[model samples]
Target: MDSYYFDEKSKFDARDPLGILYKITFRLIQIKVIKMALIFTFFVHLIMNCLHFFEILSTFDADLLVKYGPTLFPLVYGLATIIFDLMFEKKTAIVLEETFSQMWSLDSTGSKTAKKIKKESKILIGLVVIDTILATVAIMFYLPIMEWDIDIYYAIRLFEMKFSPTMSLVFSILYYATIPVLFFSMLCTTFALFYIMSYEKFQTYAINDLLKNISIDYQKIDDWKMMRDQSYQNTMYKRLTICIQRHQLLKRMEVNINQIIFTPI
Candidate 1:
C-alpha cells in the first residue's frame, strides 16, 4: 500500500473532527452501557410476564406480552451482533477503515472527486444522525403517549405490586428511565447498520467508477496505437498493468466486505 493512502493529513484521519466523531459514535454503540440497558429492558418485560404467569401481578395480559416481547428480540439481537463485531472483529474493522481512507485519498490533492465523496459521506452521516434523533423522540415521547391512550400498561403490569410510596416512586422512575435507554441503544445500533451498508454500497460504486475509468484509458491507448511509438506503447502497458492491479484490489475489497461485514450483518 502507498504511504499516501494512510497519510495522517488525509481527511479520513481519525484525528480530524468528523473522524473523531465517527470513532466516538462507533465506540458508544459497542460499549457495555448499551448492552446492559437492553438487558434491563428485556428483564423488565420478562419479569412482567413471569409475574402474570405466577399470578403475582393482576391485570397483566399474557397475549399483549407475547405480541410486544418478540418484537424487541430483533433490536436486542442486532445490537448484540454489532457489539460483538466491534469487539471481536478488530482486523476486519481495520481493513474497513483503511479502505475508507484509501477511497478518500483517491485522485490528486484536493481533487473534485475526493471532495464529492467527502460531501456525500457527510450528508449520509447527517441523515443517520437525524434519523437517530427522530427515532429517539418518537420512542421516548410519542409511543409512550400512544400506549397510555390505549392503556397497554395494564397489559405489562410493571407497577402492579402495592409498595411503600418511596419504593413505588423508585420503581416508577427506573421503569420510565429504562424505556429511553433501551430505545436509544436500539436506534443507534440500527443507524450504525444502515451507515455500514451505505458505505459498502458507496465503495462498490467507487470501484465500478474506477473500472470504467480504466476501460476509458484502455480505449485511449488503442487510439494512441495509430501513432505507433514504442515508448508510448511501453507506458500504455504499464498503465494497463496498474489498472489490472486496481481491478484485483477492488475484487479483494468486495470479497472482504462481503465476508467481514455483510455476511455478519
Candidate 2:
C-alpha cells in the first residue's frame, strides 16, 4: 500500500493557515480598495460641482477647471484601481496558483516569462508614490478650501451667510474623526495594492519553477516509457531467436534419422 498521496501530488503546509488567511484578506482588501476609491472620487467630484455651481471656482476657464477638478482625479483613481485589480486579482492570481502547483514538484527548468512580469514592480511602485503625493496635495488643498470663509474673501457676501460657528466646529470635529477612518481606509487600499504587487514577484518565481517541474516530470515519463519499450523489444527478440534455433535443430535431427534409415542396404 503506497502511503503517499499520488493523486493530489502536493500537500499545502498546515502551519501556514495564517499566511493563507492573510492572502485572502489582501484579496478582499483589493475589492474594498476599488469601492472606496470610487466613493472618495465621487465625494471630490460632488465638492467640485458644488463649488462650480456657487461660482466660487468659475473665474478661471470654468470648463477646464471643472474637468480637471471633478473629472480628472476620479477618473484617474477609478482607472488605476481597475487596472491594479485586473493585474493582481485576476491575471496574477491564476498564474500564481498554477505556478505554485508546478513548483511543488521537486524537479523544475524555470521560466523567464514570470521574470518579465516582476520587473514591472518598479513601475507599480512609481505609480503608488505618485498617487500618494497627489492624494496628499489634494487633501492639503481641500482642507483649507473647505474651511475658508469665502464670504470674507470675496466681500460679495450673501445676506443669509449665516456661517454657524457651532456647525463649523461640529464639521471640523467630524472631519477630524473621519480623517482617521479615511486614512485607515486608504491605508488598507494601499497595503492591499502593495501586497498584490509584491505577490506578483512571488507568482512569477512560482510559475517559473512550475514550468521547470512540469518539464522534468514529462521528461522522466518519456524516459521511462522508452526504457520499457526497449526492454519489451529485447525480450521478444530473445524469445524469437530461441524459437528459431530450436526449429532448425529439430529439422537437422529429422534429416539425420531419415539418412540413417535409408542406409546403402
Candidate 3:
C-alpha cells in the first residue's frame, strides 16, 4: 500500500471525502451483484451457442443450415474462445476495476473522454469488419458441402430453383450482409475481452515500470521480490481498506454529529 494511503490525514476518516467514496465502493463489491450478473450472462451466451450448434446438427435441411449454421458455428467457437481466455478470473476482475477507475477519473476537459471514446469506437468498428470477414470466409468454406443438397432440394422447389442463377447471384450479393451483423455482435463482445487482456497488460507494465524506476543494486534481489509482493498486496489491501474506511466513516459521522448537537457550547 502507498504510505500516503495510510497517512494520518490521508487515512480514511469519517469526515473525509475518501471515507464516503470507500463506503460506496465497498457496498458495490459486497453484494457481488456485478460478478453474479457477468457469470450469468457468460453462461447464457454459452448455452445459446450450444443450442445453435445442436440446431445445425439436428437439421439436414440446406436452407436451415445456410440460414443458421454460419452464425451458430462461429457463435459457439467465439464464446468458447472468450471463456477459455477468461480463465484467470482474478486478473480479469482487476482489469475491469482498473478500466472502471480510468473511465471514472477521466476529465471532460480538452476532449479527453471524447478522444478515448472515439478511439474505442474505432476499435469496435474494426472488430466488426474483422469478424464479418472471418464468418463470411467460413460460410464460403461450407458452401461446397451444400452442393449435394441442391440436387435433392432443387426438385421440391424446382420452379423456384429455376431461378437458380438469379438466386445464386442474389446469395452472393447478400453474403456480405450476414457477416457485417455477426461482425458487429462479435465486436461488442471483443470490448469485454479487450478490457480483460488490456488490464492484465497494464498491471504487468506497472510492475515492470516500478522495478525499472528503482535504481537498486544487484544485491537487493530481496528488495525487488518485496517490491513485487508489495504491489500485489497493495492492490487487494487498498480495496479492503477502502471498505473498512467506509464502514468507519459512516459510524463516526453519526456519532460526531450527534455529540455536537447534544453538547453545550
Candidate 4:
C-alpha cells in the first residue's frame, strides 16, 4: 500500500503512490518556475503545431483533417486539464491526505481486512504499471522506430524558413525529445483519473470489510438477553454509528474530489 505522512513543514507527502507521479503533478506546483516551465514547454509546442498546421491548413483535404484533428484536440484538452489540476493541486493534496489519515485510523479493526486491502493495492499499482508501459509504447509511433516517424512531419514546417532535408531531420529529433514530456503532459490526465478512481475502489473495499465484520460480530452474540441490556444496546449503537460515519466521510470525499477534478459526482 502507498503511504503518506504529514510533515511539520509540508501539508502531506506521498511515499511514491504512483512513482513520482504525485511529485511531478502536485509537488511541482510549489515550485513556480518548474511548473511554469512545464506549461511554457507545452505552449511552445502548441504554438509550433498551430503555425505548422495553418501553413498547410488551406490545402488540407479530408485525409489531412482526419489525420490531424485527433492529435490536435487531445493536446489542447490535456494541457487545459493539467493547468486546471495545478490550479487546485493544494486542495487536492489536502483532501487526499485527510482521506488517507481517516482510513488508516481504522486500520486496527481487522487483520483480515488489512490483508485484503494490501492485495487490492498490488492490483491497482500493477494497473498503473501497465498504463505507463502502454503510454511508453505509444511513443514508438512518434519517435523514429520506423523510417517515417509522424513527428518528423510535425516538426517539418515549424519555422518560416524552408528546412533542408538534413535540417528537417534535426528538427524532428528535437521534436522527438519534446514528445516524452508532452506525452507525459497527456498522461498526467490519465494519472489523475487513476488516482481518483482508485480512491473510490479502496473506499468500497474498506467499507465492505467493516460492514462484514460488523455482521459477523453481531451474529456471534450467543445471548439474546444481552440485546435487551442497556450496555449492549449502547455498544451496538456505537458500532452502527461508526458504520454510518464511515459512509458519510467517503461520500463527502467523493463529492469533493469530483468537484476538484470536474468529474460528475
Candidate 5:
C-alpha cells in the first residue's frame, strides 16, 4: 500500500466541527449502534415470536398462524441478513475506512483532480448522513402504523390466553417495545450496508481516475527523460514503477472489497 493511502489521521479529519461530528456520528450509527440494535432486537423478536408461536400451538389455531406467518417472514429474513452482515462488519469497516482515508489524502497533492475527488467524497458522506436520517424517519413513521394496525391485532389474540393480569401487561409492554426496535434495526442495517458499498464504489472510481493521471505523468516523465542524465532517468523510472505498483494495489483493494463487503449484501 502507498503510505499516502495508509495515513490514519486523514480518515476522519474535517475542517469544521460539524464535519467532525458527522464523521463520529456516522461511525457510531453504522458500526456500533446498528450492531447493538440488531443483536438486541433479534433476541427480543425471537422471544416475542416464540411466545406467539406457543400461543398458536396451544390454541391449535392453524388459521392464526397462517395469518401472522406471512407478515413475520420478511422480518425474519431481514434480521437474518443483518446478522450475516454483522459477522463480516469488522473487515468491511477496515476496508471502508482505508478507502475513505485515501480519498482525503488524494487531495494532499494539491492537484485539481485531487480536489475534485475530495469534493465528491464530502458529497458522498453528506448523502450517507441524509440516508440515515431518512431511514430513521421512515421507520419511526411506519412502525407505529404497523403496530397499531397489525401487531395490536395479534397481541389482542395472544392476550386472550389464560394468564395473570400482571404477566399479560408485561407481555404487552415487551411486545410493543421489541417490535419497533426490530423494525428500526433492520432499516438501519440496510442503509448502513448501502452507504458502505456506495463509498467503496466511489473510491474505486476515484482511484481509477488517479491511476490514469499517474499513467499520463509517467508518459510525460518518459518523454522528458531522454534528454536528462542517466541518474535522473533512473529516478524517474523508479517513480514510474511506484505509480504502477500503486495502481495494482488499488485494483486488488477493489476486488477484496467486492468479495468481503459486497458479497454479503
Candidate 6:
C-alpha cells in the first residue's frame, strides 16, 4: 500500500515478476481452504519422496545413490521446503508475501528499470525452465526406465490397486508428477532466494541516495527558523525515517533468511 511497490502505481496496475507465483502466494495467505489444500498436497508429495528415499536405501546400492543423488535431493529439498512452509505457515506466509511485495522492481512501466526487470524475470524463468527440461530429458533418456519409480509397486501393493500395464504406467506418471510440482514450488520459495538477495543491493543503493539527498536538501535551507526551512526539514525528516525503517526491515528479512532458508528443512 505504501510507495514501495511500483506495481500498485504502474499503468498495468501490476506487472509482477513471476506473476503466477505471486498470485498463488498472495492467495494462499487470503484463503484458508486453499492453504489447507496446499498443505495436504505438499504433505502427500513429501510422503512419496520419503518412500522413494526408502526404496533407494532398500537397494543398498552405492552406485545407485551416486547415480540418483542429484535428482533425488532436489526433490527432497523442494518438498521439504514446502512441507516446512506448512509447518511454519504463518511465518512462511509473512516472508513470502513480503518478498513478493518488496523484492519486485519499484520502477513503473516503460522505464529502463522496468525493461531491466522484464529481462531479469525472463532470465530467472529461463533458468527454471532449462533445469526442468534437462531433468526431464535425463529421466526420459538417461535414467533407466526400470529405475524411475515413485515407488509405484509399493503403492499398488498397499492400496490393492488394480493392476494392468496401462494402469501401472499411469500410476507411475501420477506419483512422479511430484518432480515438476516440487520444482515449481522450489522456484516460488526456496530457489528464488538468490533473486531476493540481489534486490538487497538495490535497497542499499536506495539508502545511499536517500541519505545523500537529505544531506543536500538540509544544507540548501538558508534559515532554519523560517517557515520554508522548517518545511524542508520536515521533508528530510520523513525521508530519514523511511531510510531507517527500510534498513531495519532488511535486517529482519536477513535473519529470517538465515533461519528459515540457510538452515534447511
**What Cα-based lDDT does every candidate model obtain?**
0.52, 0.42, 0.41, 0.60, 0.55, 0.53
Model 1 misplaced stretches (Cα beyond 4 Å): 1-21, 30-95, 98-112, 142-150, 154-156, 162-165, 212-265
lDDT score, candidate 3, position 82: 36
Predicted structure 2: lDDT:
0.42
Of the two candidates 2 and 5, the one with more favorable lDDT, higher being better, is 5
Per-residue lDDT value at 223 in model 6: 62
Better of 5 and 6 by lDDT: 5
Select the stronger candidate by lDDT from 1 and 4: 4
Question: Cα RMSD for candidate 1?
Answer: 6.4
TM-score sort, best first: 4, 5, 1, 6, 2, 3
**Candidate 5 C-alpha error for residue 209, in Å:** 4.2
lDDT per residue (tens digit) for residues 136-230 in model 2? 67555434355443322221122124446666556444433333334334544464545444543443344434433432323445656756686
Q: Tens-digit lDDT track for model 3 on 1-265?
A: 1111221122212322122222322223234544454344456545545554564578655675565554456655544433433343333334334334422121221243334444554564466457657766765653434544343222213324445777855643343333333333344345444533432333333333333332322234575576677665565465445435533443443354345323433
Tens digit of per-residue lDDT, candidate 6, span 159-181: 33456777766655665554455
The better candidate by lDDT, 1 or 3, is 1
TM-score for all models, in order of appearance: 0.59, 0.37, 0.29, 0.71, 0.61, 0.57
For model 2, the superposed segments whose C-alpha errors exceed 4 Å read 1-49, 52-162, 213-265
Across residues 5-88, which tens digit of lDDT does each residue of candidate 1 receive?
Answer: 212233344422144334545666557766577567666645644554455336466665564454435434544544544443
In candidate 2, how many Å is residue 225 off? 6.8
Q: For model 6, how big is the CA root-mean-square deviation?
A: 6.8
Candidate 1: C-alpha lDDT: 0.52
- Model 3 TM-score, all chains together: 0.29
By TM-score, how accurate is candidate 2? 0.37
The alpha-carbon lDDT assigned to residue 107 of candidate 3 equals 20
